[model samples]
Target: MSKATKTIHAAMAAHVSSALDALQAAGTLPEGIERGNVTVEPTRDPAHGDLATNAAMVLAKPAKTNPRALAESLAEELRKVDAIDSVEIAGPGFINLRLSDNAWRDELRAIAALGETYGRSTVGEGTRVNVEYVSANPTGPMHMGHCRGAVVGDALAGLLEFAGHDVTREYYVNDAGSQVDTLARSAHLRYREAHGQDIGDIPEGYYPGEYLKPVGEAARERFGDTYLEATESEWLPVFRGFAVERMIELIKADLALLGIEHDLFASEAELQAAGKPEAAEAWLREHDLVYDGELEAPKGKTLDDWEPVELPLFRATRFGDDQDRPIRKSDGSWTYFGADLAYHFQKAENADALIDIWGADHSGTVKRIKAAVAALTEGSGRNVPFDVKLVQMVQLLRDGEPVKMSKRSGQFVTLADVVREVGKDVVRFTMLTRKPDAQMEFDFAKVVEASKDNPVFYVQYAHARIASTLRKATAAGVAPSADGLDRLGEEELALVKVAAQFPRIVESAAAAREPHRIAFYLQDLAAAFHAFWNLGNDRPEMRILVEDDAEITSARLFLAERIGQVVRNGLAILGVEAVDEL
Candidate 1:
């Protein structure tokens, strides 16, 4: 890495480390205080300082000193650093430090040198993470409920990879469930119709989507009436396999429209065939985590078939769930929870951490799954971190009114429909405009509108405007450089300081597993860039491309280019395109 391209936080952190070393050498502070607790971040109120930290507070207990006292000593050592202009101790021992204008200028130069690689981090340390998302049942196509999870999960995996993780994107197929049985039956009716048999009226419990017609035709062509006289048991498995394969292809094609592809697809049928769920249950039984018990009827809901029966149950209450969960049903078949627990156990075998992105309808399932992970990991004498992120529903809107939706496979607003309506970038960016757990409105009109009200357009416009500046500067034989970077005035320097926070933003956002933070940060950075450009409107001297004063113009262009670089990098992590022109 070029010395000029060191991140601003890295540079400040080095100074902090050295200052701690100096204190340790002088015997003023202990030698082995944990420095991982130390952090350097930009303050929200610029009036307080350029950057702030709670290091003194974090270390005071370890150093056997009050926070304010520790801050005073730390300030004395910090002021010796050349980058710092002044240091002050705020209430409760927050240390705020202002850096010289040269620090921000050097940051701009670093960004210009590093370009797209500027904001990438090494915080993840190459730990393996398995991210499972959009595991929509292979019985149908991906619908509106699946879109948010797909985009969020993909973006999060990208963020973790950019932060130096070994990430595997995976999908778990529920092809072994009763849903697929119903799907196979539905395809059977269609298959008969394809063979010129009079089959009418899709029964109530079977899938009625017209998309299965193609699957039926394919089956008839492949088998040629061989299954026409077969028993129900003989044909059920055959048709189930055929229909599942076709639906998975359709699901994959829909995912491709949004630029999503899973690195692995785990089938529930295969896991069941391999006896994973049975093995997990046997292990839990040996550990006394599983038992034969009868469960109470669910609260606020009536079960008409509430006959009490002994079932294999997991002791979930020990791990903080409100109730012990049943893992096996009366007929000895594993429940959905049982299959899911086994799937997660398989994921935990290869990953140090596991993340599942599910629609909010599964929020209640989270606690039980986490409980199972705890019990299963305890059996292995290894603890793995498992997190389930619930993505809420997206209410589709057109213009100002709500758009009606269908849940049927062929009738729903498929992921492809939205991606086709607006561009993929728009759909992806709009999905992340809100937090994953918050209900959001996917407005077709607003997303495609070319205005500041549309965040995708606003942020993309910033990058495109910078591209225009670069083209103009190139035609006029000008380029960004630090030779006369000191010519930048206070407002320009202030903006550069904000631009330098890109690395910090990335680290914090990735650590929190919230890629939405990147979206919001890019919007803020874009607003700053546009405001800087507007200043040139009222004052001719502040214009970026001053042919007469080439040195000042070079400094301005250098700042603009760096801001553009940050915006581009941020958009890349969110899986959105940083268009050259919007």
Candidate 2:
């Protein structure tokens, strides 16, 4: 936790303890009031006071005393505390405490002492967490929609790790599906082209991207004309394996372009290898969650050949699914849901928490997956917690014009394309400027603009401005050490106080799985720093690196340096660059 949070907690505890003592002495309360229920939080309205508590209002009825009387009594008791400068009883007997400037000034010292480690926490207690994200089908390159999930998942994992979780970043490879078969066909066409064959038009229902030409050529080089004479059974597996491997390699390169690295690459095919599907089916059967049934037709999509046919189905409805879902097709091949169940079962054995970062398209699949987990665990779901975060789509634009993306035409803008165009730092920061559930608009032109309107540039500028101040301080012979911080002015003290809140911000954002909160907090911090910087222009005495006074200059420099460190640390967690001289 940050120094501000610690101070808040400590001060609030003392105040509450004193109030309890007063109540006990007056014999106006029950034997044991839960002091833990009392909380101290920054008042939403700054005019109200620095900190506000509803403790008296909460304890009034139970203590058989009027809330105002109790608040007055608590106020009298809290006035004895050293940290609080004054106390007032507000509306409904709410207690508002105004703290001494020193209490706020001490935050700067705490921030300087902790440095970059100021915001780090141990709340997660080392629980193992598996974060699976961007499990995009390896059929083609990643697009704008994929960027949001990648950034959110990566930031969340970083946040959790900072909060003391044993996080494992994973990518689930969907290699066993029919989409890969299309990829193989596409690669086969490319292979024919590579072999000097006029494989004119990309076949219908096959991938048509020019990217596969190289994979096709590689395949031809590995197996020349051999697959031409082979039967479908003999060549499909070979071609599928080759295509899948090449696609995975390309996907990895694309992810690297965005600075994403996965510790685990789980394969759906591997889950079904050596008759694992049958084993999974058997396990379900033993648990009585599987049976032969006919599924209802989907509500929206039309199925012309739909017929009532008995097939293997999971009793998903029993565990909260909307209806029983098919586990096997009419041809007896495992359905996608069946494969997914087996995959999740495998995951349950390895992780204490399963966090799947999926695009909004898969929102409907969430409930059934949860139901399957419940079925697989047979009511012992405590060992595995499933959290599915649906990342909304990103609408890309340039100069107010939509960047049309069509997957069928193989002309969709890829993640690598965006990174190359705008740089990874810009891409990562812009992707997180909004909440994950909200649709985001990524305007190529606006993101690169070096203005306050662009959040990335704004935050980076704050850090750079601090660097400029530090340089100015050193040039002016101001000692950049903590020993001189005792002379810090109110402006410098305010900046320090803001910096001290970073630890608390980190803890709250990590606990909420809201990395966007970090971005918001950084923006606020930057705004505070900028406001202070502008004050220097208006009042020379407010400048951080004051000249002709060694002690005051040193104190100001320490505060400026601490602000830069905090900006860098917060940006690092969000995977954004902290340019020292931008």
Model 1 root mean square deviation, Cα atoms: 1.9
lDDT of 1 at 279: 94
State residue 6's C-alpha deviation in candidate 2, in Å. 5.4
lDDT of 2 at 350: 74
lDDT of each: 0.88, 0.81
On the 0 to 100 scale, the lDDT of residue 392 in model 2 is 94
Tell me the deviation in Å of residue 32 in model 1. Answer: 2.0
RMSD of each: 1.9, 3.3
Model 2: ten consecutive residues of lowest lDDT: 2-11
The number of the candidate with the highest TM-score is 1
TM-score of each: 0.96, 0.90
Model 1, 398-425: lDDT tens per residue?
Answer: 8879877555424677777778879899
